[model samples]
Target: MSIQILNLNPCYDHWVIISKPPKTPNVLRGDYVVKLVDGKGLNIARVFNTLGFKDYICINILGGDVGKIIHAKCKEDGINTLEFWIEDESRINTAVVYEYEKRMLMVNEPGPVMQRKEVENFLEFFSSVLKENGTLVVSGSAPRGFGIKDMARIARFAKEKSCRLMIDISGEWLKELLNFEPEMVKVNADELRIALDLQQMNLGELLHIKDSYNIKVLCVTYGKDGSVTLLDNRAIRVKPRVIQSDYSVGSGDSFFAGYLYYEALNKSIQERLIFATACGTANTLKYGAAIFDLQDLESQLSNVDIMEEEL
Candidate 1:
């Protein structure tokens, strides 16, 4: 079975590095500038392409001229894309990288609000292209018109087709998707706590709820501290080699892509978790989102340590 990515909410992302904005009417000079598609699934797909993994397809919602730009970029990367057109233009998200502050300021727009017809059209398109027994990746925030219940419907549809559903989302939508029992879930520590409505908890506490749903794996990323994964009733903590990085916007996507890569190769579970963490750590060294240098990844991979933990 092939790999398929469903990222309904996509945006044209623009990144710029500058000192500061001028108060007077003057042109602000940027040290560097980049414009590209921004969506978690697309980020993961880029890693797939980088690793020369073919037979993968990405589907996203698009509209207006911005949509065309995303499509063109995907084509340039040699990624097969399925675009669903809507009436409203897709949103533009901008990130200003402050050289001195060493942090990025993000300004995001609410994506296109789907009409009833557009939603129906998307469902039709998803059903027509979805592959059976394939890996179904659903990621990113939703568009303005989509809600948790609507997302739950998609999860149910994937389950009906016997697809391995993997979701990387947050908030109430994450709560709703949990009901369908996805095969895999990757969330940040904050997102995991928020989803389970806990002040402080461990894998055991979360597993109390997930056990009933039969989720195969639950991964929680704790940024620099590393990540923990629960699988086969074993919880393991993965530590990565720390490296100086320009930005961390796409680390999670790279991690997920690495997990999928090893999964397709039928590697041991321990190898998958460690490789995923290394990919995430390697992504921080670059400016472009989801970009990973194989040399860096391989170097980091050797340092990735997996420690079995008491759950």
Candidate 2:
């Protein structure tokens, strides 16, 4: 089975570096700049490629100069992509990170609006690539013109194709798609709370919601605190080795990619969680989003702790 990633709102990310954290009404000079092709799906594909797993496809919409650059960068990185061209210009996102502090300030654009024909053409192409029992990952945000209906159509297509639907999105989009009974989903704790409109969130509550939606696997990450996963009627908790760096822009995406990578290898749930947490922790050691050394990932594997808890 193949892995397919769909990212509708891909962009060129420009990162600026500073010596220290920024204060309100203070002037700051950027020490340097780093640019990359960034989007949730692209980041997942990058992780897969870095792990030397080339059995996946990255799908996105490209337009204008920014889109051209992103396309070229994907080729340079040797990432396979199924591209759809549009009329609107792609987005450019900016982030300011500090050298002394581990935090970053990000400004993201909404991305290009898709035309009617563009959306229809994409659905046609999407249907052609889907295979039985393959994994279809839908990540990132939808373009302005694509709404819940458009997203539901994608979900329905996946269901008809007999694919395992995996997602890493939040807000209204997530709330609506749960009805389709995705096979797997990964979301931060805060995103889960907001998506469910719950006043309190805990492991038990997570299982309750997971069952209500009939989801097979549900993973909730708590950043540095750790993560909890519900799989095969078991609640597994994982604690990662403490790393002193932040630079956590794409850490969640990296975690998701790690889990999917292990799943592709037919690893057990416990092993998957350990590798996922390790991938997330390893991402903190790098300045670029979702970039981690293979040796670093291997070293981190021993630093993760996993246990099953009664729910």
Q: What is the C-alpha lDDT of each candidate?
A: 0.83, 0.87
Give the RMSD in angstroms, all C-alphas superposed, for model 2. Answer: 2.1
Error of 2 at 71 (Å): 0.3
Which stretch of 10 consecutive residues in model 1 shows the poorest summed lDDT? 19-28
Instruction: Please list all clashing residue pairs in model 2, or write none if there are none.
Output: none
Query: Model 1: how far is 93 from its true place, Å?
Result: 1.3
RMSD of each: 2.0, 2.1
Candidate 1 residue pairs in clash (backbone atoms < 3 Å): none
Per-residue lDDT over 1-311 for candidate 2, one digit per residue giving the tens place of the 0 to 100 score: 59989988899898888976557557777888878889999999999998999999999888899899999988998988988888999999999886877568999988998888888887787788777788899998888888788899899989998888999999988988899999988988998898888876876688888999999999888998888889766899898866658678899999999999999999988888899898888888877778898998987888888889776
List model 1 lDDT by residue over 193-238, tens digit each: 8877886566767677568767889888888878888877678889
Q: How far is candidate 1 from the true structure (C-alpha RMSD, Å)?
A: 2.0
